[model samples]
Each structure stands twice: as structure tokens, then as C-alpha cells.
Target: MSDPSEMSNVRILGDFRGDPSPSTLRLALAQVLPSDAESRPSAPDQSTAGKEDDSDGAELAMQKLRLYAQTAASQGADVICFPEYFLTGAMHSSWKAVRERQEPVAAHPNPEEDESHWLAQVAAIARESDIDIVAGTVVELGAHHIPHRKDAQHKTGGPGSASKESSDSAVASKTGLRLRTKDSSDLLFNTAYYITRKGEIAAKYTKRNLWHPERSVLSPGHPSSHPSPRLFNIETRRGLRLKASMLICWDLAMPEAFRELLQPSDSRDGPLDGPDVVFVPTCWYATDAGVKGLRWNRAGEAAVLDSLSMARALETESIIAMCNIAGPNWPNGGDAHSFQINDNTKDEDLPIVGVGHSSVHAPFLGCVGKVEDGNEALLLAEIDTKLLADARDTYRVRYDLADAV
Candidate 1:
């Protein structure tokens, strides 16, 4: 375990309430390429693959995560964030197709234990790397567990799927996997977990707004059932504590959600009333099925992303850092023609490519740093609390709203 004190006794730079003496937090966004195994056009069948094969997929993902986390730490980043559904290579249609195949039911016999096992691995990575990690969302198997990827090990026809209760019990005894949540029915959730350098799970936020495709395989998170007020604090190396929160891909399209977070709370600390920074882990794609007569829709989806991200930052007076998955041919070079648009092309002909443009946007400053195009890249930005204070002072949007209400 990493030292908890490393993140403690740090300076608490004030926000909105003033007292900002130029505190900055180094934020790193990993615009990562999907693992070659999972990025393949076709998906692997974990149902038929043995234990070693299953472990291979999980191990490969962890390896990449460690590599990215280490790079971010070396680059002096206080926190490193990965893109959504990054663990399971969400772009490939096969994962979604397989997950939707099963009727809503507990994907794992012991959903809590299974979920923890994977979460622990992520926490271990954070501890070992000694960097705060906003692990990209993963498919959680629980009551309402929707079976996807790793859950395929528990597919009806698989060996382990047979006599699940007995088999899982034996495995649990051998591994000493402890149970946490009691409800085990069925529904898949796209959940994100925040881990401190000390390997402590500081917060978990389930994606509340499901994208069109996700609705078929995933369930939206309801605050009534889960925890309320999805927010947390980050202790940066520069001695600044930032109020932060998480949102998944499609949630960016919902302005009301961002507005809700900006609403004043009952807390005495004014800064705690709203987030100083909002981190969005996304797997947003480049192409969309265009609607007739809508020029914006016909052009591309990138503009929408750019507009919403900037608006969210400016309106809420908070920094918005979005980490999106990279294009198909990322890191290494790819053909330029892959990005070219053909107006005459049919909707089916358009490739499913991540729009990239992983970026950090702040009030007034706009995009402080960004990947720029559909390619693998790392975006690092210094989030200054003074910016937040300045925005609030100049705009007075929060003040106006409070007084009006």
C-alpha cells in the first residue's frame, strides 16, 4: 500500500470562496488505443476459452494500465485518467452483442466478489504506480449484472457456468474472496472507480446516462438506488485539494446533469457545493447516423463534443477533462484516408472510429490541452484554482442563480 500521508496534510486551495494563491493540479489524460487482442474486428469467445486464455485478456489490460499510469506519474501528473469501457475494448461490436444475448440476470454467481476481484487489481495498479487513478468504466456483474467480456466465463454453456453455485463457492473458499453486496439479480452497469495512490477506493460513479447503444446492454445508474451526490476530492502533489466528479461518454450531451452538480449544497464550504473539476471518461465515436436536413448531424459528431465540453466548463465554472478512446490505428501511423469524409457514402460504410480529441477545458481558457485528432496521445494540463475563482467572479452565474431562487 502507498502512504496515505502522501495525499494528506496538503494545502487546501480555496475555490469560489476566494483564498486562491495560484494552486495548480497536474492532470493527465490517457487517450489510449485498445489492446490488439480486444481491438480486433472480431471478439474473443471467453465462453470457450480456458482459464489461462481468460486471464490473458485481463492481464493484458492491466499491463497497459500500468504502463500508462507509470508514464503519467513520470510526467509529473497528479492524477491519470483512462477512457470509458477501456478495460473491455468497448468499440468492438462483439462485446455488446454477446452481452445483449443473455436475458437480464446475475452474470456472476457471486457478483460482489467478482466485481471486487477486478477492482482490487485496478487498485493494486494505482498503489504500485503511486498515482491517483480514475480507472475507466468497466462492466460490473451484480444484481442487475449484464454479462459482457469477463462475464462470458459464466456463460450458460461454459464449463464454469455449470453448477455455478457450487463451483463459485469452492473458488471463493480457495481464493478467500469476501462478499460485499447482497443483491444478486441481473443488470449490467457501466461503473467508474476512483482509487487513491494508497489503493483506497475513494469513490465509485456509475454512468447515469446511457448512450443509445448502451441502453440495450447496460442499465442507467439511479441515485435513488445507489449513492447520492457523486463527487469526491483529489489531493494533488502541489498541495492543492480539488473537488472533482466523474461522468461517462454520452452524459456529456446532457447539460441538465452538469447544471445539477453546480447547484449549491447545504454544506458550509462553498467550494464543496460544486465541483472544481469534472473528469469525463469516454469512448465516443466519430461517426453517427445522420438525420436528413440536419447539417450539423451530417457533418460529424466532433463539433458537438467540442461545443458541449467548452460550454460545460464555462457554464459550471469548472474545468472539464475528457479522456476519450483513440482511433482504430493509433500510436502507430494509419492512412489519412481513414479520416476522410465521403458525403455520398452510406451510413453502414462509415467506420466506427473514436473521435479522439481527448481534452482538458477550463473556463475562458477553452481547451488547455487536447489530443487534436483520432490518434493515441497523452494530454496533460495544469488546472489552476485561480481560473475557477476568476470565472466565478467574472460570471457570477452561481450567485445570480442563488439569488433568483
Candidate 2:
């Protein structure tokens, strides 16, 4: 119930911004559930098709999230974050399939009429649990000007299709639909929402960086012509004020995205400092061939993901909480019991599913706490705001790099 705006009393001392009052925040990261089939309710009608299945999947996901939120709150977590696309599993299928599964954004005219009431339920859960919640990323459809590709029609045949003559026919046959160039009209975005303990939406961050496959479907938040980065200032119930920002999975790979949030902009009135903590809701995956070209024989891709998390925390001099999916690839058929939390299995013997290594990294201490590899569980870490203040004084990275291009 604390007013976030009233808590913004950061003082400007010489060249640096300082906060005299500092407090610790207990953070929790919830990995994706093992399987929906276990908790999913029986279908109303066996003949129900695509759209009905989508609805059922969304409902099941929400049910699991509610359970996680309740558990995190019971464990004394001040704020809990879910993995990216936790609601609809947007990246599990093709773009067209995602569009069918995604719920419509609440309209200003008559918000109650929207097909999915998932947002409202999320807010209610936050309020009931008395915990701040980052409700992962959602696929948002908005109108934007997208230029048409010159050979879009020809390229639609297939990845290796050379002949342009049968391009249209091949595309229709492969997808069971006609291929058409997208006009300068509507586009989709991967957007994350920050809900306060008061059950209100504090901020919304649209993903700026799109992964390779995502580029073909989703639009960038900061396109070439327009640039708008979002940040949030949250005041915890315990009277702790922290500057916070959000970055999707791929956004963590781009340093410039973090730089944009840390630096003060011309539009701001006073000197701006970097975020105290960065919440990353990711679905990062590593294959058998390893990430990029190099493979670290023993650690494999999970090590690569951890290295990125550590490097980002060290470079930014801030706390980083990375929440990732913890099960086998949903689209690809694989072991159903991979991410299950079994009491009989030893820690080392757990199945390595989706290379899950959800962790929390501190500016000074590299890895504060992390979930064991291949385990599906909540990773909690206590982040001291005073440590961040102390780290800035020792490193002076922000102050030294403030004027650098």
C-alpha cells in the first residue's frame, strides 16, 4: 500500500545519486511446471478443437501460476517472477499458432469484454498473497507500420526452395494456408507486466530485442525510428525502495539494452542511476551441439547461460535474477518426467531438462543462490540494497562510464 512515487527521494551528492535508506528484498524465481496434463481438468467435450484446446492450455497455465505464487508467498518472498511466456507458451508453436492461443489485450472502451481475464486474475493473486509479481511476457498485438519484403512471396515456399514458380503452391501446401506479405499495418510484441502488491499494474515493458526466429514473427519494442525504454520504481511493504527494470530472454544478450535503462536521458529531470535489480524472465535453451560454436564439454549450455548471467551482473554492477523454463521443449516430444521433483532421486541423478539453471547473481558476489541443474523449483535470494550502494562506491563503474559513448 506504500506510494512508489513518494518514495523516490534519491539525493544527488556531487556526481553520484545516493539513497540513504537501504533495505533487503527477498526475491523468488519460479521455473515452469513439469507438465500440464497432470493438473489439467478433463475436457468438456472430446470433440473440442484448436481454439478450445488453446483456452484449456491457458487456463491450466494460470492454475499452476497461482499455486507457485501462493507457495512463494508462504516462503516469505516479497516478489516472485515467472518464466517468459508462462501464460500461453507463446514460443511453443509457430507465430500463427501463437496468435490463436494469445488472449486479446484489454481494450479501453470496454475492458471486461476481452476474451481472456488472465490479467485481472493475476492482479487478484498478487493482492491476496501480499506479494509483488512480475507476470512474465505476453504476446500483444498492436498496429504498426511494417514495410513489405520484396521477395517475401518467393521465400515462403520453404527454407531451401530455389524455384519461384511453385512458391505460392508450396507455401499453401506446407502450412495449409496462403502466404501473403505483411502490410505496413499490425504487428505483435512480447510484453511483460509488473503488478504491485496493491493489485495494480505498475509498469509494462515491451521486449526490445527479438531472437532470430522471433524476428520473423514479433516486432521490436524500439524500432529504428522510435526508441522508448521502460523502467519501474517499486516500494516494498517493508519500506524498501528499489529502482527496477525488466529484460526478456534475448534482451540479456544485448548490452546496449541494459545501458539504455542505466543511463540518464534528456527527457528526465534529474541525474539517473542504474537499476538496483534486474528481473529477467527467460526461456533460454541449449542444444546438444552447444551454444554458438564452442562447447564446454562438462558444463555444456547451462554453463553458458550462467556465464551470461554473471557477466551481466558484474558489468552492470547490479543484482540480476534470471528465471528460466525448466522442462523439455514443449513443441518437441521428449521425456515427460524430466523436470519432476522426485524425493527419491539424488541431486546428481536428476534429469537435465531444457538446461534449466535459474539463479540470482549479485554485483560483488557472483552467484548468490541458484536452483540445482535440471531441478524444477523456486530459487530465492535475499538482495541487500546497501550492498549495491557499497558496490557502486568500490567499483565506480557507473560514474566512470556515464559520459562514455
Tens digits of per-residue lDDT, candidate 1, 1-405, equal 323443232211111223324487777888876543343542122322221223456567777687777766765777889998777656424334324433332333432234346667777777777899998877764454222233223324455455756655553343322122355444566788788888877777878777765554556666744464556878865577888888888889898788778666674443325789898999876654332212345335667778889999987889998988876542235443434445674444454555787888998899887776766666777766787888898887777666655
The most accurate candidate by lDDT is: 1
Candidate 1: segments with Cα more than 4 A from true spot: 1-22, 35-39, 42-55, 91-116, 144-184, 266-272, 289-299, 329-346
Which residue pairs in model 2 clash with each other? Answer: none
At residue 72, candidate 1 shows an lDDT of 68
lDDT of 2 by residue, 1-405 (tens): 223332232111111113323487888888774333233222211212233345566777776677777766765677888887777554324234555544434233232223346678888888888889998787765554232333254344456866764764564343332233454233667787888888887777777676655655666664432233456788887789888888888888888877777776463433347788899988765442222222224345677778889888877788888888765442235443233334453433332336668888988888887765544677667766788878878877776666563
Residue pairs whose backbone atoms clash in candidate 1: 105-186, 143-185, 144-186, 144-187, 145-186, 145-187, 146-187, 146-188
lDDT of each: 0.65, 0.63
lDDT of 1: 0.65
